[model samples]
Target: MYYINKITFSMFITITLLWSITLTRIYAESRECDHTKCVKTLADTTIDMLIATRSVVAKNQDLINVDPVSGNYYFKGFVPAMVGSEVANDFSLMTGHKLKQTSLKLRNPNNAPDEWEEKVLRSFEASGYPKGAGFGEALVTGDNKIYRYMKPIYVEKACLECHSTKKNLRPEIRKFLEERYPYDHAFGYKEGDVRGGISITLPFGN
Candidate 1:
């Protein structure tokens, strides 16, 4: 199996978000199509962002400094999940939509799934669900309608650093996680397991 170790986590997402930034404006024209076509383009754009991000980050790791300071065992401030959250926030601001990363087992309690997200996460976990396929719906809330889009994120061999079984985690990484996220259940994942997903909400009339 291919793995790039732990430090590449932030690099992976940073690159992905950058890809989203550049392409969202380019693909914004596609949203003027019919309702079904609009939502489909949005989801497709995000997935394409992933494809391009992985390819770009693979070629560009020289900028990522994984070297550790004396006492600290692993990198901080830019962990995979944290970077993902930040990336979502920035992307949301740029596009005037709500972008979020959420998981059934959360590292950041702030990312706890709402009712809709919870139901979707359960569906993702259910056996026989298609791997890597995204789910989307137009939700009616109060007097407004909105489109919610989610695409699942799968665990890779590279993800084992912070999300593998407890026994498999390096002591310092475990300790760092314990102190940072005491209620963490975002671990014990195998390579192909569903890690979580990218959730986006577009205003109804947008």
Candidate 2:
């Protein structure tokens, strides 16, 4: 059972309160902002809402500083790469922007990387590539323009429950993966291996 302390309970309540008036809160906060800044703020704050809701770990809720573009967050658990396609899809639909959790070793076809993303993924796999550094670019193709940002996700010790070597993967987890993701290749990873990347695409200036 997950036990909540005084601080955790207060945080839980805060998340509830924040979610209750999400649209209103967001609109009020971004109302005076310019277009690009508004969208970025919306995305950043929405991700804050997501991390606040999804994090349920006990003990210390450390404030982790991430890319300034992505914004900072206080999450008790791993929220970066650990957030799945479901959350990414919800974020995209809610914000009208693109959020993708993709991998070269795709477990789901829906999370397959595009050509540009594929190149980025390969670069992430390179031994000399700087770990945890994000790659971003603004591209213009005729009138269709976007800013693409990708941050690499690494395997952690906790991820081994399902993402370790075939023999080491728990029987139940392996069975479930076989049933749900028959073409799963998101395994055989040791700690610190580049798992994949979280790619965010914003239209125009955002």
Candidate 3:
């Protein structure tokens, strides 16, 4: 009877442990799904805002320059920064760090501009995603409280007028870009080619 009771107690403990593990896994999965959904929603809203603003900016020539009061341009050549600011202001309510955009063109074989561009490309390949077109979110370290969301922006036919390697860009547009970004590496793009990415940062702790 004593041996039987001991066996029964051990079985009960084992069952309890199994139940705890199962519950933990369920909770973890629930949390992950919630996080994913939140991030996706934010991305969708951000994309909508960016596309709308881009359309307006593309149409109107006057609102292109930096705002004298805010010191922010409506459509900065840096796509990532524009997207980041929009997301931070509209969706994230200026919470945490703002998003950032960066562009990468086919290296000139003469001078590559920034290191981040190469790093983004390598990361895209290593992640097993498509080389030129992909998007995702990642956690940024430093107390593990920040998240950086990234999405690739491919060049389209309309983009070529200003982005191509050929110097047929409108004189006014070329002059504006030259003055703003003297070392601009945001050109030399063809339609359907990977130009760069928009990165959005949010505080994980929030």
Question: On residues 59-141, what C-alpha lDDT tens digit does candidate 2 reach at each position?
Answer: 12333212223444322233333444555675567656577778899777888999999999999999899987777676776
Measured by TM-score, the strongest candidate is: 1
> Candidate 1: misplaced stretches above 4 Å?
1-17, 20-27, 30-33, 47-65, 68-74
TM-score of each: 0.77, 0.65, 0.53
Model 1 whole-model lDDT (C-alpha atoms): 0.68
lDDT of 2 at 29: 51
Candidate 3 local lDDT, 104-200, one digit each (tens): 5432232232454457655663555674443545455656644445666656666665678638776656776677566667677677676655555
Q: What is the lDDT of residue 129 in candidate 3?
A: 63
Q: Where's the lowest-lDDT run of ten residues in candidate 3?
A: 1-10
Q: Candidate 1 vs candidate 3: which has greater lDDT?
A: 1
Clash count list over all predictions: 0, 0, 3
lDDT, candidate 1, 175-200, per-residue tens = 87888888889888998899887777
Ranking by TM-score: 1, 2, 3
In the predicted model 2, the residue pairs found to clash are none
Please rank every candidate by lDDT, starting with the best. Answer: 1, 2, 3
Model 1 residue 90 CA deviation (Å) reads 0.9
- Output the lDDT of residue 3, model 3: 22
